[model samples]
Target: MPIIIQPAEASHVLPITELVNLFAAENLMLPRTEESVRQTLADWLVAVDPDAQPDDPPILACGALVPLTETLVELRSLAVHPSQQGKGLGGHMVNHLVQMARERGYHQICALTLREQFFVRLGFEPVDRWSISPKVWQACIYCPKFHRCDEVAVIMNLVENPQAAVHPLARPAGWNTLLKWSEWQPLRLAYKQKQAQVQ
Candidate 1:
């Protein structure tokens, strides 16, 4: 059967959600809400089975590119249905997204994943998670394993001489004191209380 890779449609939502959540259940990836998928719909790509039977689903796989900065993006919510694994669907979807990233002028793409070898096979190099950007930490702070994150960071440069375009700012030694979400929880609660009183 022919596989079609294209920008995801509203009809692809449930299949994509199910594939992602399958991995999320094993803690291999983060779970996504339907609303989050809807909002990032434009960034998503789906691979469809062109010859599916009338009752069979059309989508076989899905993934998305999440922008981290002007020159950087992260590959998120990547998954292939269990029945479809080992058939190169994941690689095909990944290559499609990489092509899309380059076409959009993004210099680098990264993934925080447990499957480092899988990404390496696709030309990604391992990097320190901190080396990416603080924006990644925004999501990390919400993760249950923030202090003990186990996911390795894999990076791939789609542009020639990628190092030449590295952002000029020096990478911080560690997360800044102010950026720790835990440090601001009290302030956040207090602000909410004040807003409630005003209302």
Candidate 2:
């Protein structure tokens, strides 16, 4: 089926949440509520089948580009409805987001995804997760999977001579496989404080 991908609007909030939560139910992605979808609707894109009948769901897939810093953005909430998998909708959505990021003047785009190969095929290279420290500090620290996130971080530089463009947040020299103590200390302390308050 042919799909028209465009920025999500007010009408897309409900179906977008439904599509994302469908994958979240299977542990394939994080869940999103209608309110969260609405609040960030400007950052989201949806693919719709223009010819679908009235009874059919209007959204086929969706994703969002969440800004992490002045130069970096993260691809989040990418999902293709089960019925639409294998039709390249996911890649199409990603390409659209990448183009959006570039047009918005972002230096790089990143994603923490289980499907690393898929992103790699689209020119994103695997990067150490900690190198994107702002992302970890902003969202990952609060995630239940913080201690055991299985997703790989991938980045694509959207500039001339992409191969030579260093990652905006390149891992410091001598950085080990694990995160440095100082690097994660604040997040660890904050998590503890959050837990204490919850208790």
Candidate 3:
């Protein structure tokens, strides 16, 4: 199938939500509602058959870049229809999102995913989940799996050599490490408090 990648349209809201929630049903990803998809439609891209009708394109795959901080963005709601899974549609969509991130001036793109190797194969390196503390505070804190998240954090540095710009969580020394460590401490304390409350 010839695939065309483009920004999502208003018509894509339902299909995008359905596609993402399909994986969420399996606990593989977060569920999205039509309203949520509509709100972030501009940040999302959908893969479709170029020959399809404009009013109801079949979304083969979809993903979005969600701004998390000044220099960071999270890759979210990446889903590929079952029929297109092994045909590289997901990878293609991800590459498109990465390019969009670079063009938008984001220093880094990260994702918390169960498919660590999938992102790793695309140049993302595994990092400690706590490394992206903003994500933890903004979303993970409210997740039911906060205390036992099974996902791995993976990052791709868009502006510099990833090796030289290693995330602080993966490095043990330096001021950056100190800052990240300081940031992580309070979160750890908060987690302990939340755990105590739950018990």
Q: What are the lDDT scores of the predictions, listed in order?
A: 0.76, 0.79, 0.77
Instruction: Compose the digit string of candidate 1's lDDT tens values, residues 115-142.
Output: 8999999998777665555566655655
Clashing pairs in 3: none
lDDT of 1 at 1: 73
Residue-level lDDT tens digits of model 2 in 126-187: 87776564444555665667678899988887875432223333456733222122344556
TM-score order, best first, reads 2, 3, 1
- Candidate 3 — which residues are off by over 4 angstroms? 52-57, 161-182, 185-199
Sort by lDDT, top down from the best? 2, 3, 1
Candidate with top lDDT is 2
What's the lDDT for residue 116 in model 2? 96
Cα RMSD, model 1: 6.4
lDDT per residue for candidate 3 within 1-199, as digits (tens), equals 5789999999889999999989888878777889988988999999999776766447889999998666678998899988788888889999999999999987878889989999989988777666574434454666667668899878887876332222355465421221132345646665775677679
TM-score of each: 0.79, 0.82, 0.80
The global Cα lDDT (0 to 1) of model 2 is 0.79
lDDT of 3: 0.77
RMSD to true structure for each model, in Å: 6.4, 4.9, 5.4
